[model samples]
Target: MATTTSSYTRTGVLEVYAKQQWHKVLATLEEDHLSLCLDESYEVPPITNNGTLSDSEPSDIPESIANTKRVVRVVKQDNNGLGISIKGGKENKMPILISKIFKGMAADTTEQLYVGDAILSVNGEDLRDATHDEAVRALKRAGKVVDLE
Candidate 1:
């Protein structure tokens, strides 16, 4: 017996590829709980007369990401507690950063700590030069309060 195979045209192949890419984008958005509104037109907020930003035009405004320090007080629970992961060890020069924040945990509940935020200091001790293990140890040593910068 011989089996027959079906082949797709170039247009069909392109459509399949496009659908796959679109699905990937949608999956990413769903993971982040984000929604897209590419078809919708929203009103832009008028530039305020703040001294920091130029009231003249949007071009004059400086684009920058601000570094913020957040202090989170997490009470130890009987079972699952503060859920967070840190990265940056001896080999890497980057400071210890929050790698993940598990849902329903104290960190997630507090909403202060976020992924990618550097864990600068723990209880006044700087962790910039500390290895990944040291950083984890510092966080473990910190009782009830986690100070991050």
Candidate 2:
């Protein structure tokens, strides 16, 4: 119900939100089948170095949720896809961030992946620095089943 904002640049987000350009942001998210929730409270992970999303350090996030890793396996077919939309990539100077998990789909069925969650890899390929197109290729090339983090 709440938005997750970890991999996006702080300054860029502020500019968009400041101007209330919600449509523009949404349009961007929908690009090339890539993938919000409206909640009042959220946390934005600070930029660490080299323009990459920072690892969750002990002081950066709550110990209870920090460094909590997850694996989401979704079955895909010609008739069905991952059912999860994403945003962010190296090209955007951000991590692969989950923006939406469609209901009654593979992703929603897992009950694990959620908006604001960052996708660190796909099928063991590290996406920490993958460009937006690279990330899209990784997902599309993953075949019928994909394991994501």
Candidate 3:
């Protein structure tokens, strides 16, 4: 594939998303009130039958990476909270990227969010152009019923 460079940002896209949907946020109980995490899970293998599949292996990249964007509703279980850690904020000239997903937590249980995933928004607040502190605030502020894009 070919590549091109330009001044492009995901913020604009997320803004449009916010307008299109209604989302509320949940607050996190962190010492710094920052450095909050989201939720995620491992990729499930496709079920196949005997002699019905090809011999070639799948792509190295996770199938989830192919989509430009998507939204998922992540409801945290009581007290467990959204199970995810993130990195790369606007100050870093990057999106809110998921760094880790705790097993058996809200994110992992949903099986939607994933490590290395770029979260454009949380509960409809755009993080595409937000700083690390701001991203943390938005994520922490999300309600029990969270929305991630």
Report backbone clashes per prediction: 0, 1, 11
Q: Name the best candidate (by lDDT).
A: 2
Order the numbered candidates by lDDT, best leading: 2, 3, 1
Candidate 3 lDDT by residue in tens digits, 1-149 = 01123344111001111443312222233433422122224222332223353222222335655445888898989877788877678787666777668879988787766665678988878887899899888888898999999
Taken over the whole model, the C-alpha lDDT of each candidate is 0.53, 0.61, 0.61
TM-score of each: 0.51, 0.56, 0.57
Is candidate 1 or 3 superior in lDDT?
3
- Considering TM-score, which of the candidate structures 1 and 3 is the better prediction for this target? 3
When sorted by TM-score, best at the front, the candidate numbers are 3, 2, 1
After superposition, candidate 2 runs with Cα above 4 Å error: 1-67
lDDT accuracy of residue 134 in candidate 1: 89
Model 1: per-residue lDDT, tens digit, 1-149?
01112342111100012421211111112332534333224333332332243222212112242354555566645556468877665557566766567778877786566665667788788887899988888878777665555
Residue 118, model 1, lDDT: 67
Model 2 agreement with the true structure over 18-67: per-residue lDDT tens digits: 23112113211332333332332545435343455543221223446544
- After TM-score superposition, the amount by which residue 17's alpha carbon in candidate 3 deviates from its true location, in angstroms, is 23
